[model samples]
Target: MSETMTIAPEQKAATGNSNKMLFAMVGIGLMCALLIVLTYEGTKPIIAKNKAAALEQAIFKVLPGTMTTAGYYWDGNAFSPLKGTEAEGQRVYAGFSESGTLTGFALPAVGLGYAGEIRVLYGYDPAQEALVGFYVLESKETPGLGDKIEKDPAFLANFEALSVAVGTDGNSLKNEITYAKSGEKQNAWEVDGITGATISSKAVTEALSTSTAEWVPRLYEAKERFKPQTQSHE
Candidate 1:
């Protein structure tokens, strides 16, 4: 003889309560997701504006005498005013004086640091074959030590006229920028590392060397395309 299986009243009650709790949890989770999405959407524009402002300030800071800036896109052949969306690997900003004379080129550079990636903006003087200025845009370096790259006067001095002269081949840098031991810089292309932040300092040097090696030749070849407008500002 077979006997039918039946759940007790108490068991059924418990199962119903469990189902209700599950539904409640799922609803709460969906509500939290919706709130997060709404908050992000609301703040996105403000974040973008702040970022743009910061970048503009950094551009001016790195390129001394830059009263205004014009965005340009390098299409591997020539530079033209940037229009519409930015293309990959086509970033270039031209700084102009109050009189609209071309000041310098503020180029973005990045490299791996002791902790993580370091980003910087540097001014390149085509006429001088040198990097004339530098500003650390972002870094995950150790505070008080690695961060000295932004404030160390002696280290910062390196970018004032770091050489990037073309090689005999006429297409590559004659010397790669390198960092020397603190107080050991012996050449225009050598940067003096910070006293206690050797790795971070080296990161800056490597970033500049690698970026300039690729960009200097291209910018030098396209120099004619970046002529000043000659329109004086009132």
Candidate 2:
């Protein structure tokens, strides 16, 4: 005769309670997930709008003397004005002076920084064939040290008129942008690196170099297109 192993009344009650608790936890998790998705969906447009506004302000800051700006998108062969709210694809900002003269272009570039990717907007003056200004759009660089790339006066001055002249080939930079030790910058195209922010400074240098190499020649060749449009009075 074998004795049957039956759960005690107390044991059965505890097991039931455990199952209920587990189910409750799963339900709570599902509810939390749904809330998160809903909140994200609701805020998406607001976030995008804020970012767009910030970028517009950055364009003006990077290209001084700009009274107005227009967005241009490069579509492989040429550039065209961006349609309303059209933000996708390769794009640039053409800043104009109060007289409607094309002042300079605010070009955005990104590169690996000391802590993460650094995004910057820099002004390219087609007439001067040089970089006129710079501003950090986004950065994850270390504080105090790497942040000096954006704060240090000496470093910021590097981009005031850094040369990015087109070469004889008419398609590439004459001298690639580079960074040098603090107080050691020798050329107009060289950036002065921060004493303790080498990586951040170098990242900005590379980003500007890469961006200018691709955009300078194209902007120079098609600069007339960026001029303000004139209306015809019939």
lDDT of each: 0.82, 0.84
Q: For residues 1-58, what per-residue lDDT tens digits would candidate 2 score against the true structure? A: 7756884656433455887898999999999999999999999989877876777788
| Cα lDDT of model 1 by residue, 1-234, tens digit | 664597465653345587789899999999999999999999998986786677778888888888877667777677877673775246777777778777888899898998999989999877788888899988989999999998889888888999998888868899988879998889988988888999999999888988898888888777667755443111
Best by lDDT: 2
In model 2, which regions exceed 4 Å deviation? 1-49, 84-89, 229-234
Q: How well does candidate 1 match the true structure in TM-score terms?
A: 0.76
lDDT, candidate 1, equals: 0.82
TM-score of 2: 0.76
Worst 10 residues of 1 by lDDT: 225-234
* Candidate 1, superposed: residue stretches over 4 Å from native: 1-49, 83-89, 227-234
